[model samples]
Target: MKEKLSFKKGHRGRTVFLICDVIFLVLLMVCMLIPLMKVLVDSVDPSTYGLRLIPKKVDLAAYKYILSKSSLYQPLWVSVYSTVLATVIGLLLTTLAGYVVIQKEMPGHKLIVGSIMFTMMFSGGMIPTYLTIKQLGLMNRVITCVLPVSLSAYNIILMKSFFEGIPGTLYEAAELDGATPMSIFARIVLPLSKPALASIGLFIAVGMWNNYMNFILYITDADKKNFQVKVRELILSDGLSGTNIGISEDMLKNAMVIIVVMPFLIIYPFLQKYFVKGVTVGAVKG
Candidate 1:
């Protein structure tokens, strides 16, 4: 009923290809690992100067400068505050909006969805957005970071795609059991949407956490300067000369970059399975 598979001469060629591929991948891994190792070494170097793979001396003044500064804590708190709010609000609103658009029976479903899709490709421009924020008195406020970017058309579409992949019979069954739309969404749909929620929530959290430009624009208060902004000024203006004698500018900068990035680097591995599953399912199902 089925022919036996044979490579014959092609087997040798396939083996050669595999060997080349592995070599190339190992080289690529080495290239990436080298730079990261250099950063780690330099950040702890007592007197950093150039690209160093080995530390001349191990000192943690770079990390200490940040941790000891009371003012720096404010920025860390701001990032956390904005990220948490945006993720929660974005997920709830996007999930509701995504669920509504998938109901073919709803009036103007096509129109509403089309309008949303339109905004993704076009925007009112930067000046208009800035002015709008200013007019709303959101200017110079910590919450400005959360409100302006709390909803993204792309995230909504992602949720919509994930929701559409769910079997329609589930909804019908829930309706027969006298579940309202809100109840069905809260209990049934959300329970099945963990993959999507994890993926999208991670995206929002990372974006908000790394949002440097938003703070530069909206938060002007001296006490409200975020972690990135503070580090940027330190590097640009010269090291905290009076306070940090032994620590180098490059060392502090590298340490700050690592601090911001390490959380996500640690987190992404845990969510990688769900993130890949969600995106793949949405792509195929949509």
Candidate 2:
């Protein structure tokens, strides 16, 4: 009759462990959610000095004031253009470089792979990189946003690992059918690589969207500045007191944070399912 119970002595330990893990996860989620809720509430609340879980009153004045500004549009366009362009270009380059690097028959392959990995561990300092950019005449241009960050070692490695897991017989079949390397890559490899592409594309897009340092350092033209720059300016300009935007500093800051973060929140849901699968493929591929 005692054996009828599923809760054996050893099973009790695992059950307790699971319960503790669930409690910890719940606490962690609450911690994260509280701050996000506070930000959302404060951004729309007229009085933003204090943190309140539930806002006493609703106000859209902060949103109206920020959105009504004319200068905001140019930076928004720049950000969108640069982010989309950079993500596309970077993804293509990463995929191609990764494919080439993974090919065992390619000559000097080890040296090329080593060089790529070497850059991952180290890089030329900012000053030298800036000097190189200057020499290349990339300053204050849209290309400056895309070119400098187009190739990432980590992304390339992840793509290579993912590609390595594809069976070689497929490629051999393609070659027997008179398919060139480019044709095989375009038709066979790319068609099977949605998860990897989505994962890498999302990473590049987020990086470009959040990039602030590059714009500040290299872009002197106001027309070339992106959304992040405008956000920074609004945050740092005495909390925008000089602009007389009619919104409180705290509220404006919160509003800007929400505005900047909104795109990623919108985007992540579409990629959420593929992200885990992509990362697992890249990480665990033999």
Q: Which candidate is the best by TM-score?
A: 2
Model 1 per-residue lDDT tens digits across residues 129-164: 888998988888877877656788888888999999
TM-score of each: 0.86, 0.91
In model 1, what lDDT does residue 42 have?
77
The residue pairs in collision within model 2 are none
Model 2 score (lDDT): 0.87
Which candidate tops lDDT? 2
Model 2: per-residue lDDT, tens digit, 1-286?
Answer: 5774555856988999999999999999999999999998998876656768788888777777777778889999999999999999998899999889988889999999999999999999899989999998888887887776767999999999999989999999999999999999999999898899999899999999999889998999998999999889867875444236566777777877888889999999999888888899988973
Q: After superposition, how far is residue 68 of candidate 1 from its true place, in Å?
A: 0.7
